[model samples]
Target chain A: MRSVATNSTARPDAIDERILEELRMEPRATSKALGLKLSMTEVAVASRIRAMEAKGILRVVAQLEFRAAGYNILALIDVMVADRKINEVAEALSRIDRVGSVTMMLGDPPIIVQVQAADSADLHDLIVNHIAMIPGVEQVETNLIIDIAKWRTGSAQLHPTSLPG
Target chain B: MLVDDVDLAIVKELQKNGRSSNREVARVLGVSEGTIRQRLKKLEAAKAMRLGLVTDATALGQTAAAYVRIKARPRHARAIAAKIADFPSCSFVGLTVGRFDIVAFISATSRDELVRVVDAEIAVMEGVLQLDVREPVGYAKHRFDLIHIP
Candidate 1:
């Protein structure tokens, strides 16, 4: 999604706000249903959605039930790489099916990758065979996620939203 | 709940366009509108599907993002994770097994705002003993879930 102006300045009209809220609550909602809820025609809701998406206000992402896909093991790996090769290493990490997301940082250990594996052996294989083979990687530290208690996303829920509110 | 190919197909279509109408989905996938609606209802009932917003925080003006590696006092890791989760800026928080007991992903709009979260919110948490804050420049590959598995 394209970054919008701050939520305040980028505030949509009352109707768009309602659309966003509705989409947020039900990502699978049809424009017809949304139109009915807003007392508008399906065509109206569909056009508004297209406009919002063009502005980077909303993005539709496929949410796979990863656990069911047998990707149960989750780990956060802090990677130290040759300063110049961070981009290459990050791109390689992204291609791996077991890797969830890679975060490239500013300092010493420049790469932080969130990985999901099937088990301990799978993680070891990723580190030794896949990630290590990627050029420029210096060191790898894997922090196994023992438990996940809670989670949330979207700019509206994070701290920045809190401060401005 | 087992998701058949049709169910996966519906999820795939909606994943690409959440607001896609059942009629449209049926037309593209060559299924009847009734079948599409039935599969969607079953998937939703099974709690295997949900709607959400996914974004790259940095792209949204959240330039400061760091992995806060933390050590908690024995059983206090759970409490500390809950604290990190409650912080408005913290996007993802979880307990880990390694050098650190807990690892969290937090982000803020600016360096100053990020520090405030670390200093005031994370540092002062009851169980946090020590932490290493590493600000990542960007996320080369960022996605919350995988729907179209090849």
Candidate 2:
């Protein structure tokens, strides 16, 4: 698995930002079509995009609808770890594919993970069976999400010069 | 799915109202119930359309969620993402087109837990930097787009 540079910075160029905006609205937008919209050559658009993705700045993934996938439960698990063993515990939890994100805190007994599974049973298996099994894991708290009033993806605005509608 | 115009119409209707029944969908799309069934089956088989159940996250008492974007050492992003995906708290993970290399959604029971997650776990993870966490104040609308059949 390739990892991004810990301190890497990505500043999307003007054209790159425009391309991203179009793709955000239509993930399936073709490079030729996008280039036409932006008044750029198809080869230019495609090459730039390919480079962006290769640099880990862009990813084209199938955004599956959550509810339709039979995953009706969303929970956030707060984890406290033994300070010295924080990495040990976190590395262990990271091995679980079901856990979506793992982040280490700059605090005592640090490390927290974001997990999503099928339901209560799946969540339990992770927290109870898998997470607890890792040595140096001090505590794990589960919080099931009830309402997500709003969720947004992508940039706030693709262009500041002018709005495209 | 090899969608015809009629099938596309059915999908459009459902995207508007997921709970719509086959009969209702057919009525809205000006098609027959049998046609709806066949199209739906084909779509499912082709992995074009997926059916899902929706619920309110707040009603369930699992409130306070945020997206944590983490940038790991160049050689560490994929391994880090794989490791993070194992926890029960992660909702989704993706390598993205932004300052951060990986992004994920995490929900907590309370603000305190949210802090624990950010300050404790995320900050200490090796090869992680540029951590940007944002909590959504309100969710305006959510929709699934239909595939445009050629």
CAPRI-style docking class of model 1 based on DockQ:
acceptable
DockQ of 2: 0.04
lDDT of 2 by residue, B35-108 (tens): 88898777766665654322224422346776776767877776666665554456456554335667666777
Q: What is the interface RMSD of each candidate, in Å?
A: 7.7, 16.3
Q: Give the alpha carbon lDDT tens digit for every residue of A1-165 in model 2.
A: 334332224445688878767766655466789889999998888787666554445444322334433455655565787644665666676677566445556543266565667777887887888877777777876655543322222221111111101
For candidate 1, the TM-score is 0.81
User: What would the per-residue lDDT of candidate 1 be over residues A1-165, giving only the tens digit for each residue?
Assistant: 334444423435688878877877777677888899999999988887776565555665545655555666878898888744788888888787677677778786788998878788998999999998888888898899988754445542221211100
Looking at model 1, the pairs that clash are A105-B136, A158-B88, A159-B88, A159-B89
Instruction: List per-prediction Cα lDDT, in the order shown.
Output: 0.72, 0.57
Q: What's the C-alpha lDDT at position B80 in model 2?
A: 64
* CA deviation > 4 Å runs, candidate 2: A1-7, A151-165, B1-150
C-alpha lDDT (0 to 100) for residue A45 of candidate 1 = 89
Highest-TM-score candidate: 1
**Complex DockQ per candidate:** 0.42, 0.04
Q: What is candidate 2's local distance difference test score?
A: 0.57
